[model samples]
Target: MRTFCVTGFGKKLKKHNDLLKIESKEDDNDEAKNLLVSPLDFDAVIVSGEHDITTGAIRLLLKNEIDLMILDHFGNPAGYILPCGKSKLIERHETQSRISSSKALCIAKAMCIASMINKISLLRSIQKNTGVDIETHIERIRKMTVQAESCLEINSLQGFECFSTNEYYSALMKIIPAEFNFTGRNRNPPMDPFNSLLGYGYGILYSKIRSAIVKAGLSPYYGVFHASYKNQEALVYDLIEEFRQPIVDRVVLTLIARKQVSSDDFNVTNEGCFFKNNFKKKYAGIILTRLEQEYTYENEKKTFSEIIEAQADILASAILETGKYSPFIYR
Candidate 1:
């Protein structure tokens, strides 16, 4: 996938209009480095903006294919999910039979299974020639599978319902403290900044992303393990969720802990709350850089994007019923 970084002014993309478009600002880039997407094309598009962007600056995004999203100053989302209108633009697939939600879930379950199997395979790869304890790894898989199952729960009524704050942050509470500050004390009630409006903002973006992804017909289940819905794209959720525990959540906490990002990064107005451009750029940098960096998985190190795409592809294969179902549960 092509990664386009939009910096400076008057930056115009030199690539052919037909190729994939990925990684950009909410508006045009005057001097984007030339790239070739080839046959596969750009997988996704991320738009980062400092403040209010030109009213129609986002029009270019609506013309592409694949995922598109706009990030705000506070490291939150502002709900311009149409990164590429052509991607969300659907033509009736008269060639192949369309699957219902139940059918899709069945396939998605298999896809999740494939992802889990791949994880095990990758773990073995991580161990290298030294070898790993199969029994121990099996146990870990079992435990992680249980957690994945919970995330995959099919809550039709509530599955599609989104929260205003980052729900993943709430999920993390189960494993870690809702720290008032990254390394500071937690008050008795614990109802201050940690659980304040900032949290609420994260939740809003999370839900919007989920809603938009589902509406686009991309499986959210395949991406992350969140509450599942019948007609939603659960696959991407299956894929992205793996990063949530250690990636997005950790970054947010660290920002708070180091005081890199504070309440000042965000401002609430009657028009609705928004983050500062610098804040969005910071969070986006953190997320992208973290994802690009290598981390140990199953005792072996790999880039975050590698594992993420693997999970997503596994779901794609499963939906196609190319193999059995599986789930991805990280250790």
Candidate 2:
């Protein structure tokens, strides 16, 4: 979908001008504030700047049908939101396909519980007739898959005992490249630390959303490589992971590399760490521009949203009739 990112580091904005573009219908000076529309407007806004959200801002965001994100100091979203009608907004979103509801639920429940390894197993199970090369991105998937299992183990048996979320996140921090920056600060951005945290969040969210799509009777896992996750929709993660590299992590890098933001843009509060007032708009701009650009993969050029939608279709067909889910494993 269209993801509009609006961040508020130190201040929140009340009005959004994204939807209203000025048009000139009459003579040169007879310009009225008419509206111009883009077929691909932003779908949601990711706000990571403050602890307590402003009600007026929430209302504005909801009216625009935008998704708002609130993250802690380290940039992790706190588990609370202001029910700004986003449920309804996201709910009626035209799903990518038409699959049966019961099949979707079963696939979603299964995917939520299965680890990356378990998923690989499921992929392997479905690989025979699909011709997907499980080995294509095996190295990266292997590392993250192992860690996901470890996280579950740590959460379950240890009762979150051995490591705090911060500690876990801290370890994740180790993966981003040392040059990775958030808004203004040069935070460590290694692959595992960076990708894993993002992957974890995306994995959870995909299951939540895919289940809805599946219930709408769409495919969950007809991916190119991981063709087997058909009923469960786990294959979407296979595609989304490709995006995390260019989307989130790259934006962080662009800001740091360009010296546009620094550590001063963040703040630590009781709720957790969040963006300071200074850098929200700047960070949001990065994501916006990035989304507008064409991304090249597998010798074809496409927008970020288009690529993901293709993956959704792949999943839809897989669930509906044992179709193959195409994985986006770039060289």
Candidate 3:
């Protein structure tokens, strides 16, 4: 299964037998026609708001249990379409009941500690390749991880996370080239090209994790570490912490180090730096490839996408008190 991203205006999607066909109504049709034959060809379809999808296509997608993600003009997630008739009511009820329980705290702390470990591990990997001395930074984050594990309250856990990440990013910026001008982390229109790539990659990752959580019969709104916010997928936010460094951060850093992304790839507006359309597609492709890459986990090789779903399943088991939750740690 794969993911198909649809963009542009006047695009129509239809189901032809077992195949999915896309046709463009624009006059200048350079990249208009597309066909998705087998149901196994794609598991997800990401459609931009500019495109028009037929009802038949939607029905077919739902029948095939293919996840659908809709993005707004600015490349932010607007909505999602998940399959119906699949329910794990007991798992969900347990999740709601355990919100304030000690189990919740354990899961939250585990996620934070896993995140810290992955960040430190990524830094070490970079240092090994580039010969950059990041031992001080790694040791500091290691101490922070220990604090996170001992934290009984969510507030203190978040505090340790913030401090650890601040130090980690500070060292990370020094390792990268100065031309990217990534002083610090900033979102809601990232301040620099590096931050822009980071934000974009994280958004893509959020959508993937959101789908996985829903498929695992958990609520995306209810969370352990991150509190629910209006219009926010809080649980997705919580689960995504452990993955941010190993997935998106690593991809963006590789792109920058290899000089694959240039200043011309971004457009500087009054808001901040944004990736141009072509560059955005290129970046998204890289992220998707990274997510599909196979890695060894628990003595078995699994794609990063599978790891995400497995993590959600583990969380559900933990919520149900049937098993313990362990966050995915990159090796």
lDDT of each: 0.42, 0.41, 0.80
Candidates in descending TM-score order? 3, 1, 2
* Per-residue lDDT over 1-331 for candidate 2, one digit per residue giving the tens place of the 0 to 100 score: 5554333333334433433233332432322334344314654445443423456556655666555555443444444332344343333224433444444433432332233333334334334424545443334444553444334222231222222222322432332345433122223221222232343234234433343333334433443223344564444443443444445544553454466655455554444344443354455455556555776755789775565566555555556566644444423
Model 1, range 1-331, lDDT digits (tens) per residue? Answer: 3333232223333334544332344464323344344324444455444323332334443444434455443324445444433344333222112544554555444434444444444344334522433445544554554444444443421232222112322333332333433222122222344433334333333433443444434544343233343454444344443344344545555565466766666554544345444454445456556556776655677765555555444544454445544444554
lDDT of 2 at 295: 68
Top lDDT hit:
3
TM-score of each: 0.49, 0.45, 0.90
- TM-score for candidate 1, residues paired by index: 0.49
- Stretches off by above 4 angstroms in model 2 are 9-239, 257-260, 269-271, 297-299
**Number of backbone clashes in candidate 3:** 0
Where model 1 places Cα greater than 4 Å from the true spot, the runs are 1-45, 50-153, 156-234, 270-272, 297-300
Number of the top-ranking candidate, with TM-score as the measure: 3
Models sorted by lDDT, best on top: 3, 1, 2
Give residue 94's lDDT in candidate 1 (0 to 100). 21
Better structure of 1 and 2 per lDDT: 1
Q: Higher-lDDT candidate among 1 and 3?
A: 3
Put down candidate 3 lDDT per residue, 1-331, tens digits, no spaces.
Answer: 2677775456788887877788766573535455455656778888753777788888898898898888754456788877774423334555564565587788889999999999999999899989999889999999998777778788898899889999899889778787778889987767788888888778778888888888777788778888635567778989999999989999988887788987788887787887776677667788888989999988898999999989988987776556888899987
